[model samples]
Structure formats: C-alpha cells, structure tokens
Target: MKNILLIIIGTIMLLSCQRDDTEQIRIKTKELISTHFMGNGVQWSAYPHGDTENGEWGKLMTSEKWEMNFKRLDYMKPKLFRVLDQANWRYMVGFDSDGEPILDFHTPEVKAVEKILSYAQKNNITVLFGEWGTPYKMHDLDAGNSDKFKGANDPKWIRSIVAYLDYLIVKKGYTCIKYYNLVNEPNGDWASTKGDFEEWAEGVRMLTAALREKGLDKYISVAGPDAVTRYDNPNSTYSGAGWVRETAKQLDEMVGIYEVHDYTEYDLVRSGGFKKYHGDIAQLMAHTNKQIIFGELGFSRNGVENQERASRDLYACEDSQFDVFKFSYGVDMADAVIQSMNAGYSGAAAWALDDAMHTCGDLGNKNELKRWGMWNSLGTELCQNPADENMRPWFYSWSLLCRYFPSGCSVVKTDSTGIEGLRLTAGVYNDDITVAIVNNSGVDNTISLNIPTHKQLKKFLYFDGDRAVDVNRFPIPVEEKIDAKHSIELTMPASSFVILTSLDY
Candidate 1:
C-alpha cells in the first residue's frame, strides 16, 4: 500500500509538470496583424464569360496613364485580367459605351492571364472579379438613359455571367480566385447617377440562386459594391459615390460577404473623405450580416495637406475626419488593417496594387496622376513593392492577418468605437488549435486574448513591413513572450502587426 502511494505521488507530480510546461510554451508573439488582404483587380466582363472580344478597342490609357517602371522585363507585368468592359457591353447591343470597355483579352493577352494565375497559385493570393458590366447589354435594356437601372447590371447578362463563372472556376482551377462583386454601387438611384435597385436585386438573387443550383453557392458571395453618400456637399466628382444602405439591406440569396467602396475619394477634401469611423462604414458592417470588403478606396494623391476637422460634419456619413496626410492617396498598410479589423470584417481590398506614379499630369499627362497603380504603371516593380519584404505598408498590414487567420475567420469584436490608431481582431486559426490576436494599432494596445487554457504556444511571428520578418523588415517587437490563455496580455504598437502560435487543443 505504501508503494502504491509513492507511485500515485509520482504520477501526480508528472501531471503537474506537464501542465507547467504547457503553460510555458504558450508564447505570446504580439502585434501580428494583416496589412492588406493581398488583392489585385478582377473583372468578369474583362473575361467575356467564355466568349471572346474579337477586336474591340481597349480602354485607351493616355501615354501618361501608361507610365512604365522602365526597369522590369516587361515594363508592366501585365499579368492582370479585366472584367467585361461596360463599353463592350454597349458595343454588343449596338449602343454607345458610356464607359470604356476592357476589350483585348484575346490570344495576345493569354500571357497576362497566365501570369496572374501563376502568381496567385504560387503565393496563395486571392483575385476577386469586381464590377465591370451590367446584367444586360446596354442598348438592350436602355439603362444608360434610364436612372433606375443606370450604372447597374442588366438581368439577362447577369444570369449568363453566373453560368460562365462556374465554367471558368472549374476549367481554370480558380480555387484561390473567389469573392465576386455582382455589381458596382446599386443605390441608383442613391448616387443620383441612376440605376435600378429592384432590378439589380433581381440580378443578384438570380446569380446567387444559380450558384446554389450549381452547388457552387457555398464558394461565392453575391453582393453590391455601393459607395456611401455625402450629406454635406451634394455636388462633387465624388458626389455619385453615395448610396442608400437599405438598397443593399439584403441580398435575395444567402450571401458570403458584403463589399463597400470608400464613399469618399482618396483626396483630403472634407467632403471627399469617409464619414467618421462609425458613421457610414462601421454602421454598415454592423447592420449587415455579410462579409464586408472595402473593394475600392484611394486619395487623389494630390489633395492639399492640413484640413481643419474642428468644424467638419462628423455625422450624416460625411467623410471629413481623417487627417490630410491620411488622405494623400498613398496606401497606409497599417491604417488599412486597423480600419478593416476594427470594422469586424474578413478583409478589405484597396483601390489597387500599384498607383503608378504619373510622371505627367494634365495636358492629357494623365500618367502624372489619375493612374492609381501602387507601382510604376506597367513596371516590373511589385504591385506594391516592399523592398524590405515587399511589405509595402499596405502589404505588411495584411501579412499578420493572413498568415495566421483562417479564410473564414470572423471578427471577434471588442467594445471600443474608434480605438484611434488601434485595431483589434480575434479569431481561431489552424482548425481552432491556435487563437489569433491581431493588433493593428500604431501604439502598443494591450490585447487580453481569451483562449482555452493549457494550450502551449510554439513561437510568435510579427509582420509590420512588406515581407515576413525572416524574409523582410519590421517584425513584431515583443517585449516578452507569454503563454497561451484567455487573458494573455501583449503590447501592440501602431507600427506593429503580429501573430501568435499555440497548441491549445
């Protein structure tokens, strides 16, 4: 009996030691956050939905718009694809194209398509097909002249596009290529640009239904890409971006996500900025049950600096709160992650990968500006070149997020409105074995992550620049590595983004 007691004591001691070790390994690799949800331009119209554009003139970028980086193998990698051009749709119906069509996706452009596919496949990136065409041909529906369905897609065309999407998805092996935006800005009638709401809704519903019928509904999201309206200044180049939230209130079919464009421009104009954090975007996300994507946003890259927000309208969805530097049209990776995560979203795509700095401006020197490519247009520079990890501020911002968070991770929101520079998002990673704590704040915000106890942590990785720390600059600056637990506290910096690894199962 005495011997039995000794064995029991030994076993108990061993168990306690095991628990202690588990606690030790729960290392808190702090401030890991997603910089930019790696994204590039996509368009179904650019695709032809299986049909080919026989020689329609492409959207002719002025020589200025074609600002080449002048250093790459092809000046412009040209691996990007275009959706159906709104102009091309008009051509199909024998009507005038209000917008330029993205024609020229023929054999000559095969290389571009291949490059996009190859890059995406290798990097595990996501390329989404956004708004490029209406549901029906332009002349066929007379939407160009009608305010109701103006700038909206036509029903017939929308249905056909869905079928084509399946074929492309299956044929092209587009596994990483999902997340489609059915139309762009459907509040017609909201922006005063004009478009049918009920018709657009029908198109969204039909396409979603088609996906369900094809058993691909689970893989796609049928939604709108509407911009928020400005209640203060009703007339401006950015005036049409405004939309009615109720128009996008609900999609007819089950949705996987909801994408919102920056209602304001990339400029510092008080009227061109987005309403205060919670006014438009924040409130929109809260009201909707769909995944939100800031699919389009950018500054004019030419706005005057130093605007006074003291007298600006912070309510009515007016976007005059961000500082002028924030509105310079340059992509701020840290800010993007902070804003998106704080909004409790899956991810958000910026205006573009490269804002090819236009060398020439007016006089049709459109290249000097207007060209929003993040890199030199048509240049070999990375879409967003992060020399130190290619973690251009935007790219680095998304790094911490994607590396650790699952594709389906939901925003486990905390109760703070404008954490200012701080953005926090919590979710399960690696099949729930690891709990991801993303801090996109510029300052060190304390993240008290709540996870199941006894889950030993392995190591932590922080991404703040363009590339991973091992591969680039600006890694997580962890003052200390704590173990895994619900109350794990770690300092997250405004410039820092990080990830934590644990075996909490």
Candidate 2:
C-alpha cells in the first residue's frame, strides 16, 4: 500500500512541473482602444515593379513580374499608395516661352505616372499625388537659401502647379488622386523652394482655392507642409520652418491631415522620444481638427557595409553581422507600427515599396536618406535567380503587422508583465481579433493569452532570425487550442515578431 501511494505522488508531481514550465498571459477582452490604419507609400514613377529590363543578368520587368510584385501589395492589402513624382517637373509639364503651362503627355515619366495611378485605381488603393518642384528657371526659385525663396507665395507659380493637377484629373483621366501635396519635404532638401510657414500657407491656400474654383474640390483635398522633422523643438527644421504651428493657425481649414516624417533611432524611442513624439502629435491634434500622420518612417542603413546588396550577397557577409542587422531592422519596423497605432494616428505609410532599377538614382538617394524599401534590387550582374528582386527582412516584417491587423481594426489594451521590451498591440476587426507581439528583449519568453471571448485560433504568423531573409523560409508555429478554462500559451522567440488571430465571439 505504501509503495502504490509513493508512485501516485511521484506521477502527480512530474505532471505539475511540466505544466508549470509553460507561461501564462492574461488579457482583458473588454478594454478596447483606437488603432490607426496601416498603409504603404511608393515611388513607382522611377521603379518599375519588376520590369526594369536593363538586360545584364536578372533585371527584367515583365508583365508577369509586375503582377507578382503587385501580389505583395495584395498580400497586405494596403489602404494608400502615396505616389511621388520625382522632381523634374519640366519633363512632366511644359512652359511656353510666355510662361503658360502646357501638359506633356508624351513623356515616359508622365506615362509611368499614369501607369502607377491606373494600378492604384484597379487595386482599390487611395492615391496621394505629390511633386518636388517644377523647372527652377520657370519659377525663378533659388535652390540655395530660404531668404531667396519666392515660389510659394508667387501667384503664377501656384497657378502652374494647380494646372498640372487639373491635367492629371481633368485631362489624362487619373481621377483617383484624392489628395495633393504641393511639396515633398518643405523643411528639407526635397523642398521645392525655401519659404517660411506663412509663405507656404499662402501657396497652399492659393492652390486650394484654385481647385475649388475649378470644381475639383469635391473630388480632391490638400494635405500638406510635409515636414521631415518634429514640431516640438524650435531647433528642428519643422519648428524652425514654422510650418507646424503656423499651418494649424493659418491654413487649418484648407489642410485635412497633419503630415510629418520620422527617421529617429529606436534607442530614442526607448529613452523618451516615444512619449515626446506622441505628446507632440497630441498637441498638434488638439490645435487642429485634422488628424495626424507619419508620411515617412524609416531608418537609413547607408554607411553600413553591404547595405545595398541583394539576398545573394548573404554569403559574402559574416553570419553574425547579417543576423544582427536583420533582427534589429525587423524589430524597428514592428516597433514603428506599434508606436503609430498607440498614438491614435489616422494612417501610417512606409517610405517605399521597391528599389526601382539597379542603377536608378532614387535607389541610391533613398538609401542615403531613408533605406526603408521592402524590396532591394540587386545589381544586374549579381541576381542569382530569375525572380530575384531581393526582398529584405523588412518585407516580411511589415507584412506581419499589415496583414494581421488590417486597416479597420480597433486596438485593445494588453498588459504584458515579466518582460521589459516585449510590446503588444491587439486589434479587433468585426468578428476577428489579432494580437501582435514584438519581442526585443533578447530572451525567449512565454506569452499567456487570457481571453474569455475568443475560443478559436484562426492563424499564426511570425518572422525572426531563423527565417528573416526569405519570406518562404519560416517554420510552422506549434498549434494551440483555447483551453477548457479559456486561455492559451505561446513561446515567443527573442528578437522576433509574432501575430495571433482569433475568432471573436
């Protein structure tokens, strides 16, 4: 009798230990919050989806290749495609010797712009048309200093730009352009001309009135003063340029969205910038009726060795170095998404979609300014496969957030204890709920999901060190069903991202 009792006790102790190894995560299903929509931004005028056709090794943009690339956009089903017309406005529109604007439909750049808009229209994506500048000679705008800037407040210059917008909507049949931004980054080099906030506001008001007078106001709206720096600090270009506060006061009714760009390091986000940045966003929102948005969010990896290489170049890089870069980049992308959603942003779009041609200047310039493209085109000689456009680890990283949460999802407050850097954003859409976990703590942790409403596990997606480089290379996560008590446990790998979708009751 004593021996039988001893055996029973031993078996019970072993089972309890096994169950205790798994971690527990408790979730509050009723506590919900707002989440911003996730979208994409692309500079398609310069980059052919897959058909650059340079004829060196793997550079060929065929119709099939274009379709394959668009399928990437389809995978995420992004809400917007902010199309940038590369500055060289002379090639897009012409000026008579008398200075009257003439629409040029024969330019390849114009045709490229048309093709991009057509794709966006077909895919149900919103289009935001933006230009860097017109011919400097036509506007007589100096490129060097703000004091010499005279283009924005100039009536003739404003009319010329408004006329081009008319050509796009009224003549060439690109009625899909719902938003127009007069300048790219008025506070930075991409600025069309140097001008203070009031001067730029005058240009914006002129353009707004012109659109309304032309009967296009019902179809299109203006979103502007797209500055790259924050508004809080006067030392920053945006604050110094005076667009942040001045636009709110002068052109509040003319502008519909407060747009800005962010390329700050992740370390700053941890140190205190997260709160400061979001606090500034709140201040802007309070000051205006319009919503706030991050038009561009990406870090440049320019000086990093092998930063421009394709996946084929993986062999040339040290395993440790490449792994760290991939992991860190993925984490940063995930963190950006979480931060934007937490701040209640209207919509957040990434910098770009692809590296146009291997030698396209946009590729090099974007690499220098913001290396945040989803696909990097390997130079003609180095592409190993016929379909090798060199999708970066970020491709899958961004997809993890966009695909799982979608645009119309509502975020809920999910408290995660025990780990320092593990952040979560839970989005609920209709009958589905998705919880995305970004683990940057460098230690494997267990996530205990306690949801009383969800009982069915819909799907699981992840990207990490073992499967960072290639989208097709990932292991299946261990399946877990909601326990009889209404809970589930997941093992989250260190320096990785995971998404869990469940059926909402």
Clashes of 2: 5
TM-score of each: 0.54, 0.76
Ten residues in sequence with the least summed lDDT for candidate 2? 315-324
Q: Could you tell me how far off, in angstroms, the CA of residue 117 lies in candidate 1 after the best superposition? A: 4.5
Give the whole-model CA lDDT for all candidates, comma-separated.
Answer: 0.40, 0.58
Clashes (backbone N, CA, C under 3 Å), per candidate, total 78, 5
Clashing pairs in 2: 24-448, 25-448, 47-356, 50-61, 51-61
TM-score: model 2 vs. ground truth: 0.76
Best by lDDT: 2
- Candidate 2 achieves a global lDDT of 0.58
- Candidate 1 per-residue C-alpha lDDT over 298-377 given as tens digits, one digit per residue, 9 for 90 to 100: 43332343233312322101122223212122224434444455444445454444332121211112212222333323
Residues 1-505, model 2: lDDT tens digits: 9999999999999988755543455555567645445443443434522333332222345465566567776665666667765333324244467755455555555565566677777766667777654335222332322232256666665666667777777887677787877776666543555434555677789888988888878778887767765423333335622566667777878886777776656675533346357546547645565666666666533334535352334323211113223646767667666766666665567766654432322222222222235654432323344344556666666665655665556667766544666776677777677777777666887776765553465444454545422355432333554442455666767777776666422
**Strongest candidate by TM-score:** 2
Angstrom error at residue 14, model 2: 26
